[model samples]
Target: MHKNFTHILTSLVVVIAITSCDIGDNKDVNPASSFLKIYDSHQFDHAIGPVDVVQTDTEGYLLLGNYRRDDTNFLGTYIASVDSRGEFIRNTYVQGSNVHPVGKFLLLGGQRYFVSMDAVGLQGYLNQVDDSARVVSTIALGVTYPMYAENDGTDQFILLSYNSVDATTVLSLVSADGSIANQSAFGIGAGQSVEEPIIDHFTRTGRELPFFAGRASSGLYYLNGFYNYTLSLLFSDLSDNNPTGVVQGQQDEGGVSGLLSLDGGQFAVSRFNFGDSYTNALATLNASGTTSSNDIQSNPMLEWEVDAKVKMISLTLDGVGYVVIGTTTKNQQIVLHFYDQTTGNYVAVDYLGFSSPYQLGAIEVTADNGLAILGSIQVAGKFQRLCLFKVSEGELLDLVQ
Candidate 1:
């Protein structure tokens, strides 16, 4: 989950089409568009990309990402606040290592905290910048292995870390005061890189039926490993480590492409299949841990072949979820997949085909309903154009739907 800086304001125009495929008849009549641009930091020598964005309790936006200089390995992780209009108000770069932040920002109490996956491992920090970007309190908990963290709102936070000794992965719940409330380990085989662990509170509270949602692994590296089918979900009390039970099992050896949890039983999960050379299904799960009535979203096929090596797939959310598919196609084109969860089939929605030679640098969603897509498009003879887009509902849909 990377966050992109740099904001652009572009007016949106609406239009309608007369297609015979009233097929679903579930789609909204009118769709809107918003264009956004990626944060350009080369001017300052530090390339800044949007990692992840979360809406703060203060009605402001928190943008989390890292900045690095091409001349040095100086990676800087930061958290900044912006208004609803996407105006930068304050910026805070985390203290210590110059590493990148790899995950989403979790809302803890009146404050917000997120996990910073750096050159070393994963470290936890806050976004409240006093003077500069400093951690109010930081901790290096869990195995040095890849880990995931989430906020539960009940004073207890949750984490999933891969354990080498046990040849298994453990899920733990930490209290608000920072204590290991509970923990449990599950064996997903070994030698697998389990990066994204999604946690949801979806069972007990009726409102909390499907609690945890994320990707796991069976350690099938190479083509199979990149399949993006190793997805799972825990639908129990997030305050507890084991969370009572899991609502779903590891389906495809697929990766947990993207995750989004909404109120009620509304949540979205994206699954990608690189081995097959295309972005597959985007499923919507209900509060009951079951796929929603319109569970599967299968639309807009994204199959691009660049320099020959197919680009990996990544997921993000602004006000909505976006599925970005990158490819080694000759032009280095990165395909953008957008879906309108309100009335989508849970598959790939609309797609925008942007061609560049810089290779997709960073892809993230903004809290202000914008998309921060960073990469270089060949310009003149050099790939120097930092692309940005403020993506909105029905906009991306218009392209492929």
Candidate 2:
């Protein structure tokens, strides 16, 4: 026991020495390969207009966003590629009325693709791109107004769209050729309407509609959106045109804020109501879908008010799994809470960009096992630009589990 204690103390000293010697330029608790970069054109009135970012197959980074102009005057599509060191490599801006980038890139059959809503047809389109950030081909989806696109846990895409005619959420299983294999319209009621959020996104009104959809491990498809005159998580069989189960919530004041799939048929979910943030660190899914009686969050990890956005992501570090809840709080900063996968207990909280305002876009795991967060920043205290915060793999492992 004496020898083991001495060896452990020596290892701790070594870790402290390395961290103190080599940290990010920010002077925060950084580790090797850690970086914080604000990526954009760097020209006046120029923004990268990032929506989502992904680590490319070449071990670099690719960001998908709007071409130019702000939310109101979108010119076309924008693709910015950065090297592994977070340095700018190339920027591709394609201005066209027929292309408007949506959803993050999905890796299908070893190829990366993303969905877009064409400005002309106003219909969802699947665009395949090469490694050089060039669009190889663009195909149109049968569904109109594709709000969110996700992989179906198989080889196809599960498009969560909206029908402008009836203001209902449309679920579709689409092929690579933009073919709809199976589709069903849901969440229709006498007074429920999704027309407001749909128009808000296209018009860049700045209003938000937190929508999420994907296939769970139980082979049931789940969608969190407005359904049955209230915000709910609608579960379906998809074989038939009816809902198999529905986890209902308050009409508009409360609902599922965010959801992320986990191993063993579990999910890490976040909830909010009247600006109060809550989270269920882990929940199981079944045929009827998961639900709660009193509060969706049994033990809240996020103490701040989540007024803007809530996102959850899971990562396995050194053979241990963890769930991280990220929020755009009312404090005008990005807050991330990491939790243990086995115990579902709160681990640590990281408050990013307290000096400047930051908004959450998407959270992803880097190729190096680090944490890559993509968001927008106010550059020079004025211009809205894309920013990335990469927490080194060592720093993250030191925090959770």
Output the worst ten-in-a-row residue range by lDDT, candidate 2: 14-23
**Tens digits of per-residue lDDT for model 1 on 201-249?**
1001111111122322211000111112234444444333333333333
Q: Cα lDDT of model 1 overall?
A: 0.40
Best by lDDT: 2
Worst 10 residues of 1 by lDDT: 8-17
lDDT of 2: 0.70
Task: Output the lDDT of residue 383, model 2.
Answer: 55
Q: After superposition, which runs of candidate 1 have C-alpha atoms over 4 Å from their true positions?
A: 1-38, 42-49, 56-60, 67-76, 80-84, 87-95, 98-100, 117-135, 140-143, 188-253, 259-268, 277-300, 304-388, 391-401
User: Could you tell me every candidate's TM-score relative to the true structure?
Assistant: 0.53, 0.85
In model 2, pairs of residues that clash are none
